[model samples]
Target: MFKRNKTRRRRSSRQRGPVARAFFFLVKAGVWFVVLSVGWVLLYKVVPVPITATMLMDPNGHTKDWTPLSRIDRNMVDAAIAGEDGKFCSHHGFDTGAIEKAIAHNQRVDRRGRGHIRGGSTISQQTAKNVFLWQGGGYVRKAFEAWFTVLIENIWGKRRIMEVYLNIAQTGIGTYGAEAGAQRYYRKGAAKLSSIEAARIAAVLPLPDERAVNGATGFTRRHGNTIAARIGVVRRDGLDACIYR
Candidate 1:
Protein backbone atom coordinates (compact mmCIF):
# COMPACT_ATOMS: atom_id res chain seq x y z
CA MET A 1 0.00 0.00 0.00
CA PHE A 2 2.87 2.43 0.84
CA LYS A 3 4.68 1.55 -2.43
CA ARG A 4 1.46 2.13 -4.39
CA ASN A 5 0.98 5.55 -2.75
CA LYS A 6 4.63 6.49 -3.49
CA THR A 7 4.22 5.53 -7.17
CA ARG A 8 1.01 7.53 -7.44
CA ARG A 9 2.70 10.60 -5.90
CA ARG A 10 5.61 10.26 -8.36
CA ARG A 11 3.24 10.15 -11.33
CA SER A 12 1.38 13.20 -10.06
CA SER A 13 4.69 15.09 -9.72
CA ARG A 14 5.61 14.26 -13.35
CA GLN A 15 2.52 16.13 -14.63
CA ARG A 16 3.80 19.71 -14.32
CA GLY A 17 1.61 22.83 -14.85
CA PRO A 18 3.75 25.14 -17.08
CA VAL A 19 4.34 22.64 -19.89
CA ALA A 20 0.67 21.67 -19.94
CA ARG A 21 -0.38 25.33 -19.99
CA ALA A 22 2.01 26.09 -22.83
CA PHE A 23 0.64 23.18 -24.85
CA PHE A 24 -2.91 24.34 -24.22
CA PHE A 25 -2.05 27.90 -25.27
CA LEU A 26 -0.44 26.70 -28.51
CA VAL A 27 -3.48 24.65 -29.43
CA LYS A 28 -5.77 27.57 -28.71
CA ALA A 29 -3.61 29.92 -30.81
CA GLY A 30 -3.61 27.44 -33.70
CA VAL A 31 -7.39 27.24 -33.72
CA TRP A 32 -7.70 31.03 -33.73
CA PHE A 33 -5.15 31.31 -36.55
CA VAL A 34 -7.19 29.03 -38.77
CA VAL A 35 -10.35 30.97 -37.96
CA LEU A 36 -8.67 34.28 -38.78
CA SER A 37 -7.06 32.96 -41.94
CA VAL A 38 -10.41 31.74 -43.21
CA GLY A 39 -12.00 35.05 -42.33
CA TRP A 40 -9.30 37.02 -44.14
CA VAL A 41 -9.72 34.82 -47.21
CA LEU A 42 -13.42 35.62 -47.26
CA LEU A 43 -12.83 39.36 -46.83
CA TYR A 44 -10.01 39.69 -49.37
CA LYS A 45 -12.10 38.45 -52.29
CA VAL A 46 -14.99 40.77 -51.51
CA VAL A 47 -12.84 43.83 -50.81
CA PRO A 48 -10.77 45.49 -53.54
CA VAL A 49 -7.10 45.64 -52.70
CA PRO A 50 -4.14 45.17 -54.97
CA ILE A 51 -2.96 41.98 -53.31
CA THR A 52 0.56 41.38 -54.51
CA ALA A 53 1.06 37.75 -55.47
CA THR A 54 1.34 35.82 -52.21
CA MET A 55 1.74 32.44 -53.88
CA LEU A 56 2.84 33.26 -57.45
CA MET A 57 5.11 36.00 -58.77
CA ASP A 58 4.89 38.32 -61.77
CA PRO A 59 8.01 37.62 -63.83
CA ASN A 60 7.52 40.12 -66.67
CA GLY A 61 7.82 43.25 -64.44
CA HIS A 62 5.32 45.14 -66.60
CA THR A 63 4.58 48.80 -65.81
CA LYS A 64 0.82 48.30 -65.87
CA ASP A 65 0.50 46.39 -62.61
CA TRP A 66 -2.93 46.76 -61.04
CA THR A 67 -5.91 47.52 -63.26
CA PRO A 68 -9.65 47.49 -62.59
CA LEU A 69 -12.56 45.62 -64.21
CA SER A 70 -13.94 48.89 -65.65
CA ARG A 71 -10.82 49.03 -67.82
CA ILE A 72 -11.42 45.54 -69.24
CA ASP A 73 -13.19 45.02 -72.53
CA ARG A 74 -16.68 43.57 -72.95
CA ASN A 75 -15.25 40.83 -75.13
CA MET A 76 -12.87 39.75 -72.38
CA VAL A 77 -15.74 39.54 -69.96
CA ASP A 78 -17.75 37.57 -72.49
CA ALA A 79 -14.95 35.16 -73.12
CA ALA A 80 -14.36 34.59 -69.39
CA ILE A 81 -18.04 34.02 -68.72
CA ALA A 82 -18.28 31.57 -71.61
CA GLY A 83 -15.19 29.59 -70.63
CA GLU A 84 -15.49 29.43 -66.85
CA ASP A 85 -19.04 29.75 -65.56
CA GLY A 86 -21.87 29.99 -68.05
CA LYS A 87 -24.27 30.20 -65.12
CA PHE A 88 -22.41 32.77 -63.06
CA CYS A 89 -25.14 35.38 -62.73
CA SER A 90 -28.01 33.02 -61.94
CA HIS A 91 -26.82 30.61 -59.24
CA HIS A 92 -27.16 31.47 -55.55
CA GLY A 93 -23.47 30.86 -54.75
CA PHE A 94 -23.89 27.10 -55.01
CA ASP A 95 -24.98 25.06 -58.04
CA THR A 96 -26.93 22.13 -56.71
CA GLY A 97 -27.55 20.52 -60.08
CA ALA A 98 -23.93 20.72 -61.17
CA ILE A 99 -22.69 19.53 -57.78
CA GLU A 100 -25.04 16.57 -57.91
CA LYS A 101 -23.83 15.58 -61.36
CA ALA A 102 -20.19 15.99 -60.33
CA ILE A 103 -20.74 13.81 -57.26
CA ALA A 104 -22.33 11.08 -59.36
CA HIS A 105 -19.53 11.21 -61.89
CA ASN A 106 -16.88 11.09 -59.18
CA GLN A 107 -18.50 8.08 -57.59
CA ARG A 108 -18.60 6.26 -60.86
CA VAL A 109 -14.93 6.97 -61.42
CA ASP A 110 -13.96 6.01 -57.88
CA ARG A 111 -15.65 2.63 -58.12
CA ARG A 112 -13.71 1.66 -61.25
CA GLY A 113 -10.34 2.79 -59.76
CA ARG A 114 -10.06 5.29 -62.68
CA GLY A 115 -12.35 7.56 -64.67
CA HIS A 116 -12.64 11.09 -65.99
CA ILE A 117 -12.66 13.58 -63.11
CA ARG A 118 -15.39 16.18 -62.98
CA GLY A 119 -15.48 19.58 -61.25
CA GLY A 120 -18.64 21.57 -60.68
CA SER A 121 -17.15 24.39 -58.62
CA THR A 122 -18.55 27.68 -59.87
CA ILE A 123 -16.75 30.98 -60.49
CA SER A 124 -17.57 32.13 -56.97
CA GLN A 125 -16.03 29.05 -55.42
CA GLN A 126 -12.94 29.41 -57.59
CA THR A 127 -12.69 33.06 -56.56
CA ALA A 128 -12.98 32.07 -52.92
CA LYS A 129 -10.13 29.62 -53.22
CA ASN A 130 -7.85 31.81 -55.31
CA VAL A 131 -8.37 34.94 -53.26
CA PHE A 132 -8.33 33.47 -49.80
CA LEU A 133 -6.83 29.99 -49.74
CA TRP A 134 -3.97 28.03 -51.25
CA GLN A 135 -4.39 25.69 -54.22
CA GLY A 136 -4.74 21.96 -53.69
CA GLY A 137 -7.18 19.05 -53.53
CA GLY A 138 -8.00 18.70 -49.86
CA TYR A 139 -11.34 18.27 -48.14
CA VAL A 140 -10.66 20.80 -45.37
CA ARG A 141 -9.51 23.58 -47.70
CA LYS A 142 -12.39 22.87 -50.07
CA ALA A 143 -14.90 22.90 -47.24
CA PHE A 144 -13.56 26.23 -46.01
CA GLU A 145 -13.61 27.53 -49.58
CA ALA A 146 -17.26 26.59 -49.91
CA TRP A 147 -18.11 28.41 -46.71
CA PHE A 148 -16.27 31.57 -47.79
CA THR A 149 -17.85 31.32 -51.22
CA VAL A 150 -21.29 31.44 -49.68
CA LEU A 151 -20.29 34.45 -47.63
CA ILE A 152 -19.02 36.39 -50.64
CA GLU A 153 -21.96 35.47 -52.85
CA ASN A 154 -24.41 36.66 -50.23
CA ILE A 155 -22.60 39.96 -49.65
CA TRP A 156 -20.85 40.97 -52.87
CA GLY A 157 -23.37 39.94 -55.56
CA LYS A 158 -22.50 39.14 -59.19
CA ARG A 159 -20.81 42.35 -60.28
CA ARG A 160 -18.55 42.63 -57.25
CA ILE A 161 -17.69 38.96 -57.36
CA MET A 162 -16.69 39.20 -60.99
CA GLU A 163 -14.80 42.38 -60.29
CA VAL A 164 -12.77 40.78 -57.51
CA TYR A 165 -12.04 37.66 -59.53
CA LEU A 166 -10.90 39.61 -62.57
CA ASN A 167 -8.55 41.78 -60.56
CA ILE A 168 -6.93 39.13 -58.42
CA ALA A 169 -6.72 36.16 -60.74
CA GLN A 170 -3.11 35.64 -61.85
CA THR A 171 -2.66 36.10 -65.58
CA GLY A 172 1.11 35.65 -65.75
CA ILE A 173 4.18 35.64 -63.59
CA GLY A 174 3.52 38.95 -61.73
CA THR A 175 0.67 39.87 -64.09
CA TYR A 176 -2.92 39.75 -62.78
CA GLY A 177 -6.45 40.34 -64.07
CA ALA A 178 -7.72 41.11 -67.58
CA GLU A 179 -6.24 44.59 -67.46
CA ALA A 180 -2.76 43.53 -66.39
CA GLY A 181 -2.96 40.35 -68.45
CA ALA A 182 -4.02 42.24 -71.55
CA GLN A 183 -1.08 44.59 -71.32
CA ARG A 184 1.29 41.73 -70.61
CA TYR A 185 0.00 39.43 -73.34
CA TYR A 186 -0.90 41.84 -76.13
CA ARG A 187 0.89 45.07 -75.18
CA LYS A 188 -2.54 46.66 -75.21
CA GLY A 189 -5.08 47.84 -72.68
CA ALA A 190 -7.92 45.57 -71.53
CA ALA A 191 -10.55 47.95 -72.89
CA LYS A 192 -9.10 47.58 -76.40
CA LEU A 193 -9.14 43.75 -76.68
CA SER A 194 -10.72 42.31 -79.81
CA SER A 195 -12.80 39.12 -79.89
CA ILE A 196 -9.84 36.94 -80.85
CA GLU A 197 -7.59 38.69 -78.33
CA ALA A 198 -10.11 38.17 -75.55
CA ALA A 199 -10.41 34.50 -76.48
CA ARG A 200 -6.66 34.11 -76.26
CA ILE A 201 -6.74 35.59 -72.78
CA ALA A 202 -9.52 33.25 -71.72
CA ALA A 203 -7.59 30.27 -73.01
CA VAL A 204 -4.86 30.95 -70.45
CA LEU A 205 -7.19 31.17 -67.43
CA PRO A 206 -6.76 27.51 -66.51
CA LEU A 207 -2.96 27.76 -66.59
CA PRO A 208 -2.39 31.34 -65.47
CA ASP A 209 1.14 32.47 -64.57
CA GLU A 210 2.57 29.78 -66.86
CA ARG A 211 0.86 29.71 -70.26
CA ALA A 212 1.94 32.47 -72.60
CA VAL A 213 -0.69 34.03 -74.86
CA ASN A 214 1.86 34.92 -77.57
CA GLY A 215 3.66 31.57 -77.46
CA ALA A 216 2.61 30.73 -81.03
CA THR A 217 1.95 27.19 -79.82
CA GLY A 218 -0.75 25.11 -81.50
CA PHE A 219 -2.54 24.44 -78.23
CA THR A 220 -2.75 28.17 -77.45
CA ARG A 221 -3.95 29.01 -80.95
CA ARG A 222 -6.53 26.23 -81.01
CA HIS A 223 -7.85 27.07 -77.59
CA GLY A 224 -7.96 30.77 -78.52
CA ASN A 225 -10.08 29.95 -81.58
CA THR A 226 -12.41 27.80 -79.50
CA ILE A 227 -12.93 30.64 -77.04
CA ALA A 228 -13.41 33.10 -79.90
CA ALA A 229 -16.12 30.91 -81.41
CA ARG A 230 -17.99 30.84 -78.11
CA ILE A 231 -17.83 34.62 -77.62
CA GLY A 232 -20.61 35.33 -80.16
CA VAL A 233 -22.90 32.88 -78.43
CA VAL A 234 -22.24 34.36 -74.99
CA ARG A 235 -22.64 37.93 -76.25
CA ARG A 236 -25.90 37.20 -78.03
CA ASP A 237 -27.14 35.24 -75.02
CA GLY A 238 -26.12 38.12 -72.71
CA LEU A 239 -23.51 37.50 -70.07
CA ASP A 240 -25.99 36.76 -67.30
CA ALA A 241 -29.09 36.04 -69.35
CA CYS A 242 -29.01 32.29 -68.83
CA ILE A 243 -28.70 32.53 -65.04
CA TYR A 244 -30.38 35.86 -64.32
CA ARG A 245 -33.09 35.90 -66.98
Candidate 2:
Protein backbone atom coordinates (compact mmCIF):
# COMPACT_ATOMS: atom_id res chain seq x y z
CA MET A 1 0.00 0.00 0.00
CA PHE A 2 2.86 2.42 0.90
CA LYS A 3 4.73 1.58 -2.35
CA ARG A 4 1.61 2.32 -4.43
CA ASN A 5 1.20 5.68 -2.71
CA LYS A 6 4.85 6.58 -3.44
CA THR A 7 4.47 5.55 -7.08
CA ARG A 8 1.40 7.75 -7.48
CA ARG A 9 3.26 10.82 -6.13
CA ARG A 10 6.20 10.19 -8.50
CA ARG A 11 3.85 10.03 -11.47
CA SER A 12 2.28 13.38 -10.52
CA SER A 13 5.68 15.05 -10.28
CA ARG A 14 6.77 13.73 -13.64
CA GLN A 15 3.62 15.02 -15.31
CA ARG A 16 4.08 18.58 -13.94
CA GLY A 17 7.72 18.85 -15.14
CA PRO A 18 6.86 19.05 -18.87
CA VAL A 19 4.16 21.66 -18.26
CA ALA A 20 6.55 23.89 -16.28
CA ARG A 21 9.23 23.60 -18.98
CA ALA A 22 6.76 24.50 -21.71
CA PHE A 23 5.54 27.54 -19.78
CA PHE A 24 9.07 28.84 -19.36
CA PHE A 25 9.78 28.25 -23.05
CA LEU A 26 6.78 30.33 -24.01
CA VAL A 27 7.92 33.15 -21.76
CA LYS A 28 11.38 33.14 -23.37
CA ALA A 29 9.84 33.21 -26.82
CA GLY A 30 7.64 36.14 -25.85
CA VAL A 31 10.63 38.13 -24.68
CA TRP A 32 12.49 37.50 -27.93
CA PHE A 33 9.46 38.54 -29.92
CA VAL A 34 9.26 41.84 -28.05
CA VAL A 35 12.95 42.55 -28.63
CA LEU A 36 12.69 41.79 -32.32
CA SER A 37 9.58 43.89 -32.74
CA VAL A 38 11.26 46.88 -31.07
CA GLY A 39 14.29 46.46 -33.32
CA TRP A 40 12.13 46.41 -36.43
CA VAL A 41 10.30 49.54 -35.32
CA LEU A 42 13.55 51.40 -34.78
CA LEU A 43 14.85 50.25 -38.16
CA TYR A 44 11.69 51.32 -39.96
CA LYS A 45 11.94 54.83 -38.49
CA VAL A 46 15.11 55.50 -40.49
CA VAL A 47 13.25 55.60 -43.78
CA PRO A 48 12.14 59.04 -45.03
CA VAL A 49 8.47 59.94 -45.18
CA PRO A 50 6.87 62.28 -47.69
CA ILE A 51 6.85 66.01 -46.97
CA THR A 52 3.14 65.92 -47.84
CA ALA A 53 2.09 65.80 -44.21
CA THR A 54 3.64 69.22 -43.62
CA MET A 55 3.39 70.68 -47.13
CA LEU A 56 0.28 69.45 -48.90
CA MET A 57 -3.10 70.79 -47.84
CA ASP A 58 -6.02 68.42 -47.58
CA PRO A 59 -9.10 69.47 -49.47
CA ASN A 60 -11.10 68.86 -46.33
CA GLY A 61 -8.70 70.28 -43.76
CA HIS A 62 -5.98 72.95 -43.68
CA THR A 63 -2.32 71.91 -43.39
CA LYS A 64 1.01 73.65 -42.82
CA ASP A 65 3.42 74.43 -45.66
CA TRP A 66 6.67 72.45 -46.13
CA THR A 67 10.00 73.20 -47.79
CA PRO A 68 12.38 70.70 -49.31
CA LEU A 69 16.02 70.79 -48.23
CA SER A 70 17.07 71.66 -51.76
CA ARG A 71 14.82 74.72 -51.64
CA ILE A 72 16.10 76.02 -48.27
CA ASP A 73 18.46 78.96 -48.20
CA ARG A 74 22.07 78.55 -47.00
CA ASN A 75 21.61 81.53 -44.70
CA MET A 76 18.58 79.93 -43.07
CA VAL A 77 20.60 76.84 -42.33
CA ASP A 78 23.35 78.95 -40.81
CA ALA A 79 20.97 80.85 -38.55
CA ALA A 80 19.35 77.65 -37.34
CA ILE A 81 22.71 76.12 -36.55
CA ALA A 82 23.82 79.24 -34.73
CA GLY A 83 20.62 79.78 -32.79
CA GLU A 84 19.62 76.21 -32.03
CA ASP A 85 22.83 74.21 -31.82
CA GLY A 86 26.11 76.03 -32.00
CA LYS A 87 28.02 72.78 -31.82
CA PHE A 88 25.83 70.78 -34.18
CA CYS A 89 28.77 69.50 -36.18
CA SER A 90 30.98 68.72 -33.21
CA HIS A 91 28.64 66.69 -31.03
CA HIS A 92 27.51 63.12 -31.51
CA GLY A 93 23.83 62.31 -31.27
CA PHE A 94 23.75 63.47 -27.65
CA ASP A 95 25.10 66.59 -25.99
CA THR A 96 26.10 65.47 -22.55
CA GLY A 97 26.94 68.85 -21.09
CA ALA A 98 23.74 70.49 -22.24
CA ILE A 99 21.67 67.52 -21.11
CA GLU A 100 23.22 67.64 -17.67
CA LYS A 101 22.50 71.31 -17.35
CA ALA A 102 18.91 70.83 -18.46
CA ILE A 103 18.41 67.99 -16.03
CA ALA A 104 19.64 70.13 -13.18
CA HIS A 105 17.38 72.97 -14.25
CA ASN A 106 14.36 70.69 -14.44
CA GLN A 107 15.08 69.30 -11.01
CA ARG A 108 15.07 72.80 -9.63
CA VAL A 109 11.82 73.55 -11.46
CA ASP A 110 10.17 70.41 -10.10
CA ARG A 111 9.43 72.31 -6.86
CA ARG A 112 6.72 74.57 -8.28
CA GLY A 113 6.19 72.88 -11.63
CA ARG A 114 6.43 76.44 -12.94
CA GLY A 115 10.13 76.97 -13.46
CA HIS A 116 11.62 77.74 -16.82
CA ILE A 117 11.69 74.79 -19.20
CA ARG A 118 15.11 73.74 -20.35
CA GLY A 119 16.02 71.78 -23.48
CA GLY A 120 19.42 70.29 -24.13
CA SER A 121 18.23 68.33 -27.13
CA THR A 122 20.29 68.69 -30.30
CA ILE A 123 18.95 69.26 -33.80
CA SER A 124 19.17 65.53 -34.47
CA GLN A 125 17.23 64.78 -31.33
CA GLN A 126 14.62 67.38 -32.21
CA THR A 127 14.32 66.00 -35.72
CA ALA A 128 13.94 62.46 -34.44
CA LYS A 129 11.20 63.52 -32.05
CA ASN A 130 9.42 65.74 -34.56
CA VAL A 131 9.49 63.16 -37.31
CA PHE A 132 8.58 60.00 -35.41
CA LEU A 133 6.51 60.99 -32.39
CA TRP A 134 4.05 63.47 -30.97
CA GLN A 135 4.90 66.13 -28.38
CA GLY A 136 5.16 65.25 -24.73
CA GLY A 137 7.63 65.50 -21.86
CA GLY A 138 9.14 62.65 -19.85
CA TYR A 139 12.10 60.34 -19.55
CA VAL A 140 10.39 57.75 -21.74
CA ARG A 141 10.11 60.09 -24.71
CA LYS A 142 13.61 61.35 -24.13
CA ALA A 143 15.03 57.83 -24.02
CA PHE A 144 13.18 56.82 -27.15
CA GLU A 145 14.12 60.05 -28.90
CA ALA A 146 17.73 59.60 -27.88
CA TRP A 147 17.80 56.09 -29.26
CA PHE A 148 16.23 57.23 -32.50
CA THR A 149 18.56 60.23 -32.66
CA VAL A 150 21.61 58.01 -32.39
CA LEU A 151 20.27 55.79 -35.14
CA ILE A 152 19.50 58.80 -37.34
CA GLU A 153 22.82 60.48 -36.81
CA ASN A 154 24.55 57.22 -37.59
CA ILE A 155 22.49 56.42 -40.67
CA TRP A 156 21.60 59.78 -42.20
CA GLY A 157 24.59 62.04 -41.41
CA LYS A 158 24.48 65.80 -40.67
CA ARG A 159 23.23 67.08 -44.01
CA ARG A 160 20.39 64.58 -44.15
CA ILE A 161 19.31 65.40 -40.61
CA MET A 162 19.13 69.09 -41.47
CA GLU A 163 17.28 68.28 -44.68
CA VAL A 164 14.64 66.27 -42.85
CA TYR A 165 14.29 68.95 -40.18
CA LEU A 166 13.92 71.76 -42.69
CA ASN A 167 11.23 69.78 -44.45
CA ILE A 168 9.21 68.81 -41.40
CA ALA A 169 9.68 71.49 -38.70
CA GLN A 170 6.51 73.40 -37.88
CA THR A 171 6.88 76.90 -39.30
CA GLY A 172 3.37 78.28 -38.80
CA ILE A 173 -0.31 77.34 -38.57
CA GLY A 174 0.00 75.81 -42.02
CA THR A 175 3.64 76.36 -42.77
CA TYR A 176 6.46 73.82 -42.60
CA GLY A 177 10.07 73.82 -43.77
CA ALA A 178 11.73 76.61 -45.73
CA GLU A 179 10.23 76.39 -49.22
CA ALA A 180 6.61 76.49 -48.16
CA GLY A 181 7.15 79.27 -45.65
CA ALA A 182 9.23 81.27 -48.12
CA GLN A 183 6.80 80.81 -50.98
CA ARG A 184 3.72 81.53 -48.92
CA TYR A 185 5.17 84.59 -47.19
CA TYR A 186 7.97 85.93 -49.33
CA ARG A 187 6.77 84.85 -52.77
CA LYS A 188 10.11 83.20 -53.45
CA GLY A 189 11.97 79.89 -53.20
CA ALA A 190 14.13 79.22 -50.16
CA ALA A 191 17.41 79.59 -52.04
CA LYS A 192 16.45 82.99 -53.33
CA LEU A 193 15.88 84.53 -49.87
CA SER A 194 18.04 87.61 -49.27
CA SER A 195 19.68 88.05 -45.89
CA ILE A 196 16.68 90.02 -44.63
CA GLU A 197 14.25 87.48 -46.04
CA ALA A 198 16.23 84.63 -44.53
CA ALA A 199 16.41 86.47 -41.23
CA ARG A 200 12.67 87.08 -41.22
CA ILE A 201 12.04 83.42 -41.90
CA ALA A 202 14.49 82.34 -39.22
CA ALA A 203 13.02 84.81 -36.74
CA VAL A 204 9.62 83.18 -37.03
CA LEU A 205 11.05 79.69 -36.51
CA PRO A 206 10.19 79.72 -32.82
CA LEU A 207 6.58 80.29 -33.86
CA PRO A 208 6.41 80.16 -37.62
CA ASP A 209 2.77 79.63 -38.48
CA GLU A 210 1.41 82.41 -36.32
CA ARG A 211 3.88 85.25 -36.95
CA ALA A 212 4.02 86.59 -40.49
CA VAL A 213 7.12 87.59 -42.45
CA ASN A 214 5.24 90.58 -43.82
CA GLY A 215 3.34 91.44 -40.67
CA ALA A 216 4.71 94.25 -38.52
CA THR A 217 5.43 92.15 -35.45
CA GLY A 218 8.20 93.72 -33.36
CA PHE A 219 9.41 90.39 -31.97
CA THR A 220 9.59 88.85 -35.43
CA ARG A 221 11.62 91.70 -36.86
CA ARG A 222 14.01 91.74 -33.94
CA HIS A 223 14.55 88.01 -34.14
CA GLY A 224 15.04 88.29 -37.90
CA ASN A 225 17.89 90.71 -37.38
CA THR A 226 19.50 88.38 -34.91
CA ILE A 227 19.32 85.52 -37.43
CA ALA A 228 20.67 87.68 -40.25
CA ALA A 229 23.70 88.67 -38.20
CA ARG A 230 24.28 85.03 -37.37
CA ILE A 231 24.05 84.17 -41.06
CA GLY A 232 26.93 86.50 -41.80
CA VAL A 233 29.08 84.63 -39.30
CA VAL A 234 28.10 81.27 -40.78
CA ARG A 235 29.02 82.29 -44.33
CA ARG A 236 32.39 83.47 -43.13
CA ASP A 237 32.81 80.18 -41.29
CA GLY A 238 32.01 78.00 -44.37
CA LEU A 239 29.62 75.02 -44.76
CA ASP A 240 32.21 72.38 -43.92
CA ALA A 241 32.72 74.15 -40.61
CA CYS A 242 29.03 73.55 -39.91
CA ILE A 243 28.41 70.06 -41.33
CA TYR A 244 30.15 67.02 -39.89
CA ARG A 245 32.43 65.34 -42.42
**Highest TM-score against the true fold, candidate:** 1
Candidate 1: misplaced stretches above 4 Å? 1-47, 52-64, 97-118, 241-245
Best of the candidates, lDDT: 1
Model 1 lDDT tens row, 190-211: 8999999988888888776657
Error of 2 at 79 (Å): 1.8
Error of 2 at 51 (Å): 5.7
Note the residue pairs that clash in candidate 1.
Answer: 57-174, 58-173, 58-174, 59-173
Model 2 stretches with alpha carbons more than 4 Å out: 1-48, 51-68, 100-118, 239-245
> What TM-score number comes out for model 2?
0.69
Candidate 1 C-alpha error for residue 17, in Å: 16
The local distance difference test score of each candidate is 0.75, 0.71
Q: Estimate the lDDT of model 2.
A: 0.71
Worst lDDT window (10 residues) for model 1? 55-64
